[model samples]
Target: MALRLKDQLVGQVVDGRYEVLSRIAAGGMATVYLAADARLGRQVALKVMHPHLAADEVFVDRFAREARSAARLSHPGVVGVYDQGAEGGTVYLAMEHVPGRTLRDVLTERGALTAGEALAVVTAMLDALASAHRSDLVHRDVKPENILVGLDGRLRVADFGLARAASASTTAASVLIGTVAYLAPELVTQGRADARADVYAVGVVLFELLTGSLPFTGDVPAQVAYAHV
Candidate 1:
């Protein structure tokens, strides 16, 4: 992407180890890249925080939470993180790289999944969340895009970047930490989330998998959030 120019990562090495190959995806806080581990001689997914977020002191804790959360999990249903550190303006987390499509991509291509198909997809997701919950981590975002359905047919729930890494629900100054459409009611009103909140999000994902649409629609974001509430 054009943004990569501003990020002197792709085609260059970082920390004298990972050789950022190409940009994979971009999100609100970070841009993910496919990279080669020069020492290990293997491929890994590298998530580098946006220059703004990396430079902002406000997001440091949240960024570290993602690194710790993913690094702690070794479940088959969840992607494993290998390393995390910052170099100059780049704060990056290197993790497992999976080749595949996301649940959202599946829904877009197939128009919706049958009951059986949807169940299989969500069950894998649930197992991953169950692992996270048992580890005292609550994934704040559990949307379809964060769930990867690998080309080898494995389901991997990802992006533990924003979370309640503590066992208790957290109150954040930000209005929300997850996708507004899948946010639970309590999260909307109180800005706190527990394991049940993750379950609720998965349930919504299941519904969307079946219908190929979100339950609530709106002309603007506020209206959709109101519908969710």
Candidate 2:
């Protein structure tokens, strides 16, 4: 397997608490690692921002603060956030380590799912999102890639890198966050997100599960963004 530069911390320790074991997956914003928590004597998934992204003090501080808030959210369907810390310039979140494949992987391997199966998958995701909504947290980015299917066949919603509270829209996000295919229309135009935005993304996810394709198609991101608008 090809190793990413961010995955180079395979055997290193973070904040003197978590010991990185192996790389799990890398995403557009962060790379997740399987790690052992030395203080707690347990396993945790450590999600660290890419060095380049972590370099921005504004982004890093926001990430750390949001992660700390997410840690207070308790729900079975939502992947738990355990701890958040920054060592040097590397910011990381210690999360509940779940052994699973992403919904994207499932869709790639097996095209469209039956209505019942699709409902089960999406229902679980909505459950997680619903919990977040109740907590005033809007998962701004909800896509197949952010939906995890566990080894035991349970579904859990993961990734809150772009999540924001309903009341925290005082300023727009610095960058256009989230996968374009699943982005809600209002998020692109007004730069505001809320529970309804997550609901929109959940609808898009359901459509993908049922149809085996996205609702909008475009050769470039701008085209998709335009379509969303």
Strongest candidate by TM-score: 2
> Can you give the TM-score per candidate against the true fold?
0.89, 0.91
**For candidate 2, lDDT tens digit of each residue in 109-211?**
9989999999888788888888888888778888888888889998888876444421133332323433777878997787676789888988988899999
lDDT of each: 0.78, 0.79
Candidate 1 Cα RMSD after full superposition onto the native fold (Å): 3.3
- Candidate 2 residue 205 Cα shift, in angstroms, is 0.8
C-alpha RMSD for every candidate: 3.3, 3.2
**Where does candidate 2 stray beyond 4 Å?**
1-7, 161-178
Clashes of each: 0, 0
lDDT of 1 by residue, 60-114 (tens): 6566765776688889999888998888877888889999988878878898899
* Model 1 TM-score relative to the real fold: 0.89
